[model samples]
Target chain A: MKNTILIMGHKSPDTDSICAAIAYAELKKTLGFDAKPVRLGKLNRETKYILGYFKIEEPELVTKIIEPQSEDMKQDIILVDHNEKTQTIDEADNANIIEVIDHHRIVFNTANPLYYRAEPVGSTSTIVAKIYKENGITPTKEMAGLMLSAILSDTVIFKSPTCTEEDINIAKELEKIAEVSIETYGKDMIIAGASIEGEDLADVVKTDIKLFEFGTKRLLVSQVTTAGVNKLLETKNQIIEVLEKIMKEENVDGVVLMLTDIVLEGSELLSVGKYASLIGVGFNAKVGADSVFLPGVLSRKKQIIPKLTEILI
Target chain B: MKNTILIMGHKSPDTDSICAAIAYAELKKTLGFDAKPVRLGKLNRETKYILGYFKIEEPELVTKIIEPQSEDMKQDIILVDHNEKTQTIDEADNANIIEVIDHHRIVFNTANPLYYRAEPVGSTSTIVAKIYKENGITPTKEMAGLMLSAILSDTVIFKSPTCTEEDINIAKELEKIAEVSIETYGKDMIIAGASIEGEDLADVVKTDIKLFEFGTKRLLVSQVTTAGVNKLLETKNQIIEVLEKIMKEENVDGVVLMLTDIVLEGSELLSVGKYASLIGVGFNAKVGADSVFLPGVLSRKKQIIPKLTEILI
Candidate 1:
């Protein structure tokens, strides 16, 4: 019998991370592999809405990729959406990553040769959909819907600079299969995902947090999309306190939270911790107290991370 | 105008490394990219014989992937065959690695998402050949011959344990295109590659060297194929001296030389420096002075690196 393989995404599960893991796991299962989809953390509002709308269940929550006591079993895992150690599940270093299907910058290595397929696309779902097509397996309607929602969520309805032509084309094919109007369903999903009202400031700040190492320094970058950035900024001091607390707790050198306004196609950037001033230097903007508004900064992967890496490193 | 993209393999250019780069560059050029294949070092006798057989010129030798004075140029590179920092050319850290097509264990990272396609196969030429087929482009006779020889050379005419069904199938297709009998051509290539009659001890030992870092300790592993291990063993002391000199000059923790006998399907292992005994410990074999012969050990990637990593790390 083949060993059971777990398919997982990065922590603080976003729509792309959660949905791509499920979709790829489904594809793997169809191909006769004993694969199961898993999530590293609780699904955010966006992912929950997407799964609910498509009548799909959330993946099994796994705190760690490998159980410490089960070392003899040698758990095999396939990573999706993200491939960075800082963003992956706990004890991922111990897991035997047999394959990776990602649409993110790679900071991964392996002791043995394995299957790795990464592309500079908007979403991991786009790549998964292409894989399904390559394998001559059409995704079920529910699966197609989940993957389409993930693409729309990650690409911000094709507004993100990270969105590629392949993503748009794959989304169109998926939309046809799911029998949904792309514009209507995409807008509804985006608007549903953008609602963060009545949520705790700490939860909002930590929802999509990712840690990045620049030279010897570590920086934590968090992002949350909202229709109303100005409304969220009303509690700026509380957010700063939460960010600072997270920095100290995580022992990171700096913390940055991007309160992105999807409609405005920009972000209200907030900074805290030791290297906060470097953000201003990186983006060539003024950091007033703790916040700055940057126009046309939609993607953390394409826009923010590259700029931060350049200045910080 | 499109920017010139350099397609390169790892240093100490082997048959698979050299041929895969040329084949991939040819594929990219056909797809309308300005790509050029380059080598990091002089070709080995096996590689030289393969290129001569195919009537293909050697790739331009490049000392560095990116020149220090041309930092603004941002040289775009597509790595083939290997993807480790220690094995890559100098200044590769500065080059914009846009794509990678390799068949080795990955220890690569990039700040931006790029096209990375890796598989666990015997040779990179097998993957490149598949790409050619995927694009609906049949390789020319010379290209087919080159790729076929590469697969034969790396797989030791399908004798290495690393050889896969895909490699065999791809070689069959390439053999027909190249109009060469697989068994005849493959044996000829392997036999031609095995002759190290009058080569210097230093040249023989350093011909196919690879550097690996295990937790802070760096180890240099080199391999040379021959049909006659006894012939090479006559000068074992001189080879040990050369390995010792390499350890000191390169500041490595250890140096290992595997005199692989393709016909016998085994390697006569030699070691020097601080972690030399660990090699014997890794293989569960007794070390006598500086040599140990392990039966049925062929692929370094499959047999050697993993064992070394397990014990060393």
Candidate 2:
């Protein structure tokens, strides 16, 4: 009732998503607006490293939300993801998403009149950087450094397909303010987050889950991740098939799964699509002898969405 | 000689610049290559936020390299910016650049031999996300989230003038691997960075500097900072006159400076141009107004470059 705004992001909160949500909320507050940051899934090891870097505490993990999409979302409940990208929602001058921030390809079925922008950079934190710019705001050195670190972690030092030059520039600027070396710091951060000693696999997946809706054909895009590479590939198909059955029973459109080989720099995209070819062609997957093989596919957001949009559209 | 790579960023180092250097170096090392990230200019607060987010230290700041820009850059010199989009140096197979990454609008520059990609996102860290997606590539969750955070920071949570939808989506996806909350965490990062106490006003300007080249002329663009809006506006004209003299004394074609009031969400763009009218049109500044009154202009890379380019071209 206090003009509450839900700051949400994608599932599986990363540094970009987490930092964007937090920065955006702060910006709104500075602009005299009430906003709360929410996450769709749990935090990961790398995100923890970023949080630790800034000496900020991480948010709690959230498994379920009231709705799948933010569009036409019930005023009673707001759906927020870790990536902080809003998909759909009705626009209202007041209390209707005043802004939606993200760094992924745009995909929303909403009739909301709101301020929205999505860039081609590696992370949503890049978008947050602009928010500070928009408000004539400059982040504290520590804050800037943390956001810069988030960009480096997601963009892979700008080597991945998803990176852009702006990301690199912004990171550099923030680095100066933060007074730290990103290359050396990034290595230390990665080493810090490498431990997956004791955790529930399902819990990890649920922590960063996203609910997708295509014309009421609901689907759950659950990104399951493991620390090792070969282990994920070995049982990739089995995991997909099982997830597919689970989705079908739940009256969902399909289950699109990712078997990520983090070390090899590729992903095994498995889907139970009623129209597999359509989805496959959309994703630019190899017309495999059996299952679809996305060579050099590292990101579901960058690789799969483009193809999926083509198919879905 | 030992395959050393010098990583360079745009004139002003932002979150993407800082993170790309670190993440890319890590990826190269994983691929069994020698790489080092370098900052073209001094870093800023946002970059510090990102580094802190990932718990990674910052890279050494390099104001300039004695080496010149060339197609025959050695492996020791990696010229990386945060604005290369569409095509990248990776297209060339013969050049020793070996790899390139960025997050700004695409450029028309010729490609060099290297592995590269330019996304439409706002930060270079988005590219780092793909590196994590590689097979057998296992960056720490903190590293992954660090990249994601950097993207959001650079893109202003996908709200900047240069943001795209793809950037938002990729950031969302990276959240899973990074395990960060976009809203709260990002807010913390920025807040930490916004506190600029004990900062040298001159130091802020000297770092993260960009150069503008016009027809038969050149301009050095830099930003000076103040704690509040009062000091910034008070010293606007004095700063401009001083910069103009310095520009002439240095024998440079032009000098444009920004008196950024981080708290007020505005900037006073000051410049001394031979073609004052052209510069005015380029910056949308008024005649005799002294400095351009820009509401919410924080990023020289994102806010100023494109507009200036339009006027220059």
Candidate 3:
């Protein structure tokens, strides 16, 4: 008998990772596989709201999937999340993983026996969208909503440079399936997620942060979204100061802070040290004494990465 | 004098295109422009069904919008149907179409001055989705339902290759707003649109037939969807025979008949010509006497064109 497999993604389980696991499980069922949708962490308010809109119960949180990606057939586990707790294949108790898929830069290591796929794309939801498209599986609105939500969350409402035409197309398909106006949902979700009243300045800068290595110099990119750009503008200096300390602590070459105005279709870019001029020149932005201002840079992923990479490297 | 602008695509006024036009018009109003959404052709039963489901009336048919995108102006107009009858654009218009935006590959050169945009992505609705995204606009559930309906109709429930990530994302968003399941709604809509019993075989195929030109070859790709592929499968040869005649009469390089089985997640690719093998080879597909079984193939735009172009060129 095949054992039950709990499919999941990173902690804070954004829409794409959550929905991909669910849709894939549904597809696995169609293809005669035993799988279940699992989340590694608690759902955020926006995710909860979208799920409630679709009347879908929140998927159970599975701390870890036993056998993750590869073929040791050994009961090794791969840990994921900011806190990074350990989990192993023996704990998942599944005979085989069948498949492990994600869009993040592949941080986990696992020992498993089965199929797995990973690619560097805008969102994991795009990968799942392709799977459903290639399988001829018509997604339910709940799944579509989840996928759309994931894309919005990951792409930061297409602000992230991670978004592609494929991501946009998948978002479009999911929009019809989920039956929500993405722009409306995206704006609302961004607004809901952007409550920065009492959060730590460091926490705000670290919220959905990613690190990149360019040559000998390391780069830290942090993205924060608000309903409007005013909040970030208000806390601009504090954020820059916090990032400076974190950079020193992390021993990073350069650090950048991006405050996305979800409703305003642009972002304010703050940079420290040697990277400021590079980013400023590449983005054709307004250069200040300590930072650069991007007039139309709402999405950190889409707007910053390409230009920064061009200049940094 | 205020000018009248009519917005439409093909015959059916779907959710994205329809709602986008409405939302854009609303945005235009905020920006000091007058616009209205207009349907060029009559809506099928599915459009009517979804509209009834959402308790909204169908938009008036504009027959054609005389305005063009180049002028960057808005207008009021009269409505007309396929029968060439007319009404005041205000009295007959379904939604306000200030600018014409589409994603279908078919380029237009109309009698009216048209402000048109067509992107080679999945659905015209996706373009509308972007308008709302660009303007920070929010749509009501009823409006979201209209956009989702358009997307479902145009994308063939996300099976249409024309579907993009944006389309899927929007579909998901719309699903929540419309309070309907994407899969269930898709099944119902496909069934509603799947009436081959009374349709003239040739006429059915002729209606909404898409033409593609590659090198010296012009391929005629006709799509007809049915709930069950089996019944259509029974009439396949007959449909093929009619398609062959149509292809010959139209003087095209080749003919491909796509009998889309929406629920089944596959397409029966029937081609009649020396070029049939060209498509088979391009897609790495299995070929019969005059056909190929395209597994996991859905959209006519996404799947067929890329494959066909590679082989023919």
Candidate 4:
């Protein structure tokens, strides 16, 4: 139908990105709106595990929101988790973004007014769960499970600096509804997501990346969480090669990858491309040839992006 | 204190703009925040009448949100009713927009995530009233009166095309708390605002204007609601001269004034400058030198701006 609205997150879907889209789409459907959840990219390991555990179908993948053949048709969308043009699906500039439910820095604008709800929280799922509670609609067990997983994943099991009291409260409520133990389930999910043993180095470097614009420079920042940072560093040269290719292809001034060890609560930062050394200058850490270990740096949004933005802008 | 947050509306503030800012600031204060309401420009007659009738003090007027001497000090702001940088106070770009509660097209962006709530409602007062209800805080009689008056003024007593069912419901609840009959009070406020008798033509033309950019062309759209459109038309040449001066001074491609008649429920469109004839082409009406009467056209946001944007872009 022409009125059918697509709900999606950003390209390179993570747990919160995919789960928030599905949960919000379900909320919209209960409110008598024709909505479908879609994903911009393949699901990551943790998101795949959660969806499989919950017996929820993976959202259909879509590269372009508006097709040329459907240019005259109304392609209404509701963005969740992310709002930047650089991070969304292709041809999003041509689609009608009717609503945005996000918890990230806003680099978005629209010509007409619509429903926009943003909060400085750990995850978009926190806001979505809050909305469901506000509307007096309890989520189904499957939806609750997905949302709980997303909160845990995005907040790094409540260890992230971005986590808030609201996120913890909502996660507790969702844990009860989903009949899951937060400690055991969250640990399992995080461990599952952190395993990159069989994955290609290029895909590992490409996944969970975001493009940021600072003044005149474009930078691509990527993060991969693991249980052992040294295991990933064993392939440091290969990762740097992949980063350099991505920087050239994306036409960004710099590329950075954070090899985060969840248990260690730190990240081994790898930098490549034009403005790589500025990362060390921004963080006040000595720049190694390619990498430096920053202790207690878990959040890309809070611990990394803002610092880089300050130095770059 | 450095933590004081200023809440304000756009330049040439209207009833909804001023009242919504005041009500939201009060809500923030009740929630234990250091908040103060401010206005970007002198209040229009309708807003001044509502505040005076309710015995509420007018908000402080501020031209620039940040002082150059206090550049290192935190200047946090919350915008209400409007979000476009072109319509907000001077130097808003330098201020930290911590929150935005708006009911207009979004042309706003931020580097950091914050509380942003927008809805496609008739007035910002409608959203503000809903928030008060959600938070379990009852507005005082004075605040309720101001909010009710704003809904009536912005919705043209629920006659404008932009009026929504939520506006009417919220207005009724606010009217009861305000202890005022909606019909009589709304009529008095509207009539008071519509009277342009003894006012300078230039001042009337300059009030309630918004700058819109479409495909590199900037258009200044001004609106004035009156009971007697014919009386205002008597000074059409003088109004055109003022529009011409504003067009040149603002360096805009075009300037348009919509002389709306609240009782008649129509607007007489006047155009000046380079893109003048496009207004007639956009509305499919005959362009008579400077003016064209469009019956059943009362909303600049709903009817006029979208049509002009379609033609211009």
Candidate 5:
């Protein structure tokens, strides 16, 4: 276990993060490296369902980056999905980070050379799939299903603006390999995760929060996909309470919790922080006591974050 | 042409740099982007012979990074082989750098997002070749030969420490695609580049010099693989003059010219600038006149730079 290369993504691991970590570890293992996939957070319902469907065991949960000893310092790290120190484990800064496969803006630089594959696509799994093809490793049908499901989750079934032609092309190839229909499977996978019934309001808000940094300013934006925004709005006050606590604990300039409705193709934003009103400024809409309507804004990466950065930064 | 993406590698480009750019541009073009390969430097004997052997046209040379107009700012730039500001063209800092595929330490950071694919391997062409496979595009016979030659040249025919199993494996696969014997082709390609007859002394020294930085200290290390060290050592005085001139002009802390003998598997070091005696400190060798012999040292990336960096920095 100690000798095995631990492959993982960022905290609050989403479908794309977990699938990519596993897929990449499978690739490294195919190349004769002793590798295993781990997750920073517990699997959500959507990921749990997908893994169960494929009959693959859930990855081990790693809440902390283990403190490195002298011999352990030589251990290799391969980070996927996110690259920020805030998003990754604390001990990540000390380990020998050999490679980073992510889909976010790079805020990390190292003095020594390392392998980094960062593509501005919908999902990290898409890039990992490409890597599998590159090394001439045809993924198993089960692996193909997981990768295809991940692409659908991250891109919101091609409804989100982050969906590129490359993503669609790769997903189409994966669909044929996995023997899944795009319209039926993509919609089914996305809707499975959107069910927030058996969860706490705080847990729902905290599931996919990503910390974004621009210059000296820092912000945390939490997003959750649901079938209906109105279902989440019932507990809007409780969601704001958790978001504010997280903002204070994380010491971010602002906090935004977006309840994105997959069917409506929009989001309801709730927030409280130092510059929370700047969101209203950027979107050209007035914020109510708790939330604001964001029409046709589904992706945190493509729509929300860039729009906020353009205004706030 | 205006919409065509200008793909290029670093200044003083090598076989890997030129071939990777051409190959990556081919991959992107196959994916339906208007991409064209460009070179930052004139071809040396090695690259010229390889391209001529494959019957491929030389890429258009770009001495400077051209400034883009208002609307042209959207023109995407994809850099290969290097990402350092010192190594890249001046206009690159201002251009819309969309993707960077390199094999060196990354010092480049951007405000906005971009695609970056970096691997710690022998040649950038290996990464480009993998991209070819990922996109399901079979490389042309000419392209395969170019990529295969680059791996051999950069890895010094797998004798250098930078040659990984992945590089060797890729080269073997490329050998089949190129219809060439690895043993014969690799040796012949290397020997073809070692001819320095009638070449200017400065041009020989300047051809493969790479700038390295540790903290604030900047140094240039120029290396050339030859059949025998005696040829370069005979003109040591004339070489020192050029090294000194380059040190002053480039504003670097120091300079070392390595004449690496392919057959003997060692390098003859010529030094001029601050901390000149530290080479002797690191290698425990006597420096007489302008040169010192490093026995059993075959690579600048592995053998020379890291050893000197440990002592000097």
Candidate 6:
């Protein structure tokens, strides 16, 4: 059997991570590689909905990559969306990462030189789409839809500050290819994602958590979206209790959750520990009894993370 | 008076940083931006030597960027080579950043969206050269020489793993433009940089010091090259004593200095504190009396920093 090369994103797989992996895997297969898309964690509602809508096969869920039995180590890994080892799988340290198509900060390095294409774009799927265009290999209709959905999802319909002109331009072209009205489809997709139901409060809060470290301050920011903002805010006490537990468990300086309302177009910030004033200054949100409400804030990548980094770091 | 946009690299500016600022400022001028190159710190021997060789004027030294008086705030700052606020000038945090062309990890963000182009390459000079090419601006013979020297210095004559094929290819093109042989000029440059004279023990060690923080475990690494290894080692004890003092003052966990031999192509590691075992694991150098010698180590960016990050982070 030919050794299968795994194309994967970081843990806590987001829409960009899952779609970038699937789309890049398709691109690599077109370029004659035995590549397969894989996810590090279980697919969230948004990702599952995307895969279901596109009729694309869901990628196999994997916790770690198996070490190569033979010497052709270069065919083992192709990391997407992230380059940090802390965010990646356990076996990523040993794997020969042949290519990294990411949008985040660069931290990982390789012994042998590899194809590393990292940009400060909003979505990794934006990079994957560029790779497809550069190679002159037209993506399949399913691939196009998946990639386009990833772009729209990550950029929050181009409202994110992380969205570049290239991202908007590419997304425009992709919208045509995917045959979806961006304005209408984008709202539906976001609303679909925000309609959270049937999950425990703790699981819902931890749905899309990501770790960011700026010097000694290790912060874990978890985000959840809902159409009905007040419904999620009703269970604030339970959320904060679990958040405190998670903060201690992860040995982090702080743990916070962004209860975003896609319909209302803002977020309620729930956080613990010494970072509230820092958050108050950073987010410009009015502090209330136990939480703060952020208006016109859409992106954690551009708004929340950058603000936190500036003040804390 | 027309407002001047300042283009500069990080403090303790290396050959790449200084030359990148010069090259990028030139590129921006060709595109008709009222830009002037500036240096945050005094130029090192290698940088001074390169500017002298090319007959290009050294940039005006600037310790801080002044606040904008009126409306045109975007023209205040244009950062190159580095994006971290810790590495940049004091006023950069408050200034309106118009653009950034860097090759390091992304850390800084602005209130308004701006032009940011960051690539994972060996040197920021390489990025500047490519920017010139992209804009269809032909560099002068002197500019080519300065940029070529920057690349060679940053990559240590293409022996660094950070050097991509694009760097080697661009350097080849630059050599023809500059009318100099790469092999001879590269060695001459390295040898000249290694000939450290008329500096005290503490200054010698602190000349190229950079602070790196992996969470709370802050580290200060100082690298100095010399032709004669024994010349640097003679004052190792005094260096260690000062390094310990500096570490405590800076509140860093460890301090290490790499006494690299340019001709011999190796480094004798002198360290103070608990990170020695981490370094021992990192470098595989046998810890001798207050120092360990490692053979065939040319580039600290590739060999030293990555290993230390792995062990510490």
True contacts kept of 5: 0.66
Rank the candidate models, highest lDDT first: 4, 1, 5, 6, 3, 2
Report, to 2 decimal places, the DockQ of model 1: 0.69
lDDT against the true structure, each candidate: 0.87, 0.60, 0.63, 0.88, 0.83, 0.80
Encode model 1's per-residue lDDT on B120-185: one tens digit a residue: 999999999988886789999999999999998889888899899999999999999999999888
Candidate 6 docks with a DockQ of 0.05
State the lDDT at B228 in candidate 2.
61
For residues A1-313, could you state the per-residue lDDT of candidate 2 as single tens digits? 3446667666545666676676666677777887666665667787777777788766545444444255455332233222123433223222344444555433332332233344556777776786577457888776786678778767755555877887888888888888888778755665455444465444444444566666555556655443354554565555556766667666777767665443455566667757555566666667752245455766656676556655675
lDDT of 6 at B146: 86
Off by over 4 Å in 5: A52-55, A67-73, A111-113, A136-138, A172-192, A210-220, A234-256, A270-295, A305-313, B111-113, B173-192, B210-220, B237-255, B272-292, B309-313
- Model 3 C-alpha lDDT versus the unseen true structure: 0.63
Ranking by TM-score: 4, 5, 1, 6, 3, 2
Q: What is the TM-score of candidate 3? A: 0.43
> Which lDDT tens digits does candidate 4 get at residues A17-124?
999999999999999999999999889998888998999999998899555456557589999998889889898877888999999887777877899999999999
What TM-score do all the candidates reach, one by one?
Answer: 0.82, 0.40, 0.43, 0.85, 0.85, 0.59
Q: Judge candidate 4 at residue A281 and give its lDDT.
A: 68
Indicate the docking level reached by candidate 2: incorrect
Write the residue-wise lDDT of candidate 5 on A104-148 in tens digits: 888877776788999988889999998888677899898899899
Better of 5 and 6 by TM-score: 5
Q: Put down candidate 4 lDDT per residue, B255-298, tens digits, no spaces.
A: 99999997777999988877788777777766455688889998
Regions of model 2 farther than 4 Å from truth: A1-313, B1-13, B28-46, B60-79, B82-95, B104-113, B134-138, B175-181, B184-200, B213-218, B223-231, B252-254, B259-266, B273-288, B296-313
> Could you tell me how far off, in angstroms, the CA of residue A6 lies in candidate 2 after the best superposition?
42
Per residue, candidate 3 scores C-alpha lDDT tens digits across A189-243 of: 6677777666677876775678887777788998777776775677667777898
Which parts of model 3 have CA positions greater than 4 angstroms off?
A: A30-32, A42-45, A64-96, A102-121, A133-136, A156-162, A273-287, A296-303, A309-313, B1-313
Specify the poorest-scoring 10-residue window by lDDT in model 2 chain B. B106-115
